[model samples]
Target: GQHAELDVMRKVEGVAISPRDTVLVDQGMMTGRAGIFAGGDVIGGLMTMTAATGHGKKAARAIDVWLSGGHYEGHEKSPPVDFDMLNLPLFLDAGRSQMSALPPEARSGFVEVVAGISDREARYEADRCLSCGNCFECDNCFAACPEQAVVKLGKGRKYTVDLDLCTGCAVCYDQCPCHAIEMVADVAALSAEAHRPLRFKARP
Candidate 1:
């Protein structure tokens, strides 16, 4: 009975009556009927924080459009700010916080699975992040290079290594505190690769 109706219901839209007495609403958006929107777990699917936030934003925009006699675009027109430029302090390290698990005996039955870290412990963990100099550009090589070859392209421009006058001296690589800059070989000429072997055989 389950397999018979499930096969039929899969093809149908809106409402479907199955032999197993299961009621399926395939498209919830159509069921709202009033043209007002509704969504989330009640409609049935994976519900996450990100999805909920997005749905809320969509609903608010729709309401705004309806209230304005449908003339409004119902979308935020402001350009989003680049998060890298925001310079907000990261509250935690790049790694996930270690959660204290319930004991095996306790875990067998229903019990709170994870314990929270204390305020002091959380703060100590947050402090461990190596801020890695200024948010994007580390000024170490910029400060150290005597040739002054390294140029700040601006906030929009990622680092552009000027090979024309770079000389392949590797002074920039040496001075970088965060080890971001690497001394890559100049590939402009075939002669540059003469000594730098293309590939090496593994040891026998």
Candidate 2:
């Protein structure tokens, strides 16, 4: 709380800010000086709890790698998902559930305004998630793959494609609601397409 102004500065002693901006971060979330990494509100851009959480995670990873004498190269930024990209049919049309609130009489002090939802309500709310841009491991790929190429690695681990068994039929890719699966053709597949015989129709 005391270092609130540090939230707006260009650099912090050993750290160097970008020439073009006040933000301090390189590929590995490293500041110019050794070992020190900065993120969160200090880095600017999206000023939200989600953005701060992401920064904290990235900074932690970078710090760990720095300690180990390695670098944590973060992923390249991709374009944000648009509403059109979402598979709306996969999500139920459920209205946002309001949190149970304390009665006006009980709101005199600094008590929390909203109470937690019931387990059933939580489940219902979770069911309404569109799961845009990220994989929620729905197992649609596991079921859709005729060759049984999709390996279920249990919750949080997600599924991996068994390339040997995957014929590149793209049934799994097509069936994926989140568009998480990608069909990457091998050199052999590409060469086969180049050499495939084109049939000529006989003149009637």
Candidate 3:
């Protein structure tokens, strides 16, 4: 059995104590009081270090918004990327980069045993991410298109297909490894609705 001592917190007015003996807060982690907020173990639920860290980050952002007289409007929630959505063939089989560590013979008391990886190694390891359902500009669709309808919009600007040049062959859709491209059928009208911008956010 565990208990949270709310003796000091009880002095604060407008705060509500839940039936479970935890602090009742809103979506922004704010309690009944206008400026007061609660998070971490005091708020209950999964009491883990990772959860506490996430709470701290969220609370900090909320506090910043409150200070600026603005409501904390978080980013639009998106569905989690599952393993099945990943295009495994597009990425090469590269092993994870391991941190440099001192040998057992060289180990000493109080001395750091593990060392941070080099910038190059860090970049290499980060690049290994699957980036599931998102396009990383692999240029597969551009190369696969028979009509050369795929227009290259350099760097961060994603590609767009020229509808006039496109023949509805669906070659670009098939070649897209990350499932970012989707096929929409409308033979009667091949207007703007037929095309979708290839933005950073992938289609669910």
Candidate 4:
């Protein structure tokens, strides 16, 4: 129910305020004044915890870049992962871990009701994540490739396919458990070689 004291900020030169009484910011969450930034509730629009957290993270990055005298281009956003994209067969069907809670009879004013899961239970629940479009480096594509085209680029670097060794087989694409590999026609090879060439797009 508390209101934002925007009147105080209005006195500052080059700071913009919207018609909705919210602070105005640019793509980098910066105000009209240089080195100044605002986000979350002050910026208005979607007023949720998740939105606020995202805003905070973005603003922090922008602030860091500004401090370093560099422009913040920001990280590219990936497409949303759909349920159908997940390899359901790879993950076991496990029920959600239930948290312990106090009984109705034990309930009291300002008392905690739900008790959170243990560290082991939390780890188990985390392991159940389908990972969807994100590759977990399961080595399925590496093993399934008949021509040994899939090349491991070490940990966190992901895999790359050797175009010379690849024979246009969709084995790597089919073996990818997370659906991270996409098969597209190599236009350059098709135009030059007069035959279709396999291009694997493995998103990191």
TM-score of 4: 0.69
Using lDDT as the measure, name the better of candidate 1 and candidate 3.
3
Ranking by TM-score: 4, 2, 3, 1
Per-residue lDDT value at 39 in model 4: 82
Q: Assess candidate 2 and give its lDDT.
A: 0.67
Q: Give every collision pair in model 2.
A: none
lDDT of each: 0.48, 0.67, 0.76, 0.83
Listed in order, each prediction's TM-score against the native is 0.33, 0.65, 0.53, 0.69
Cα misplacement distance, residue 141 of candidate 4 (Å): 1.7
What is the TM-score of candidate 2? 0.65
Worst 10 residues of 1 by lDDT: 195-204
Q: Which residue pairs show collisions in model 4?
A: none
What are the runs in model 2 whose C-alpha is more than 4 Å off?
Answer: 1-13, 16-23, 64-68, 77-80, 99-127, 193-204
Off by over 4 Å in 4: 1-25, 29-78, 193-196
Error of 4 at 26 (Å): 3.0
Model 2, span 1-204: residue lDDT tens: 322245334435667665545456786667777777767666677767789788887788788888998878775554555677666676666898888898888896778888889898989887877766567878887898898878888888877766667676767766777656544436665667733122111111
| Model 4 C-alpha lDDT per residue in residues 17-120, reported as the tens digit of each score | 98889889988899888888888778887877778788888989999999999988887665776888766676668889999999999999989899999999
Best by TM-score: 4
Q: Tell how far residue 45 is off in model 4, in angstroms.
A: 5.9
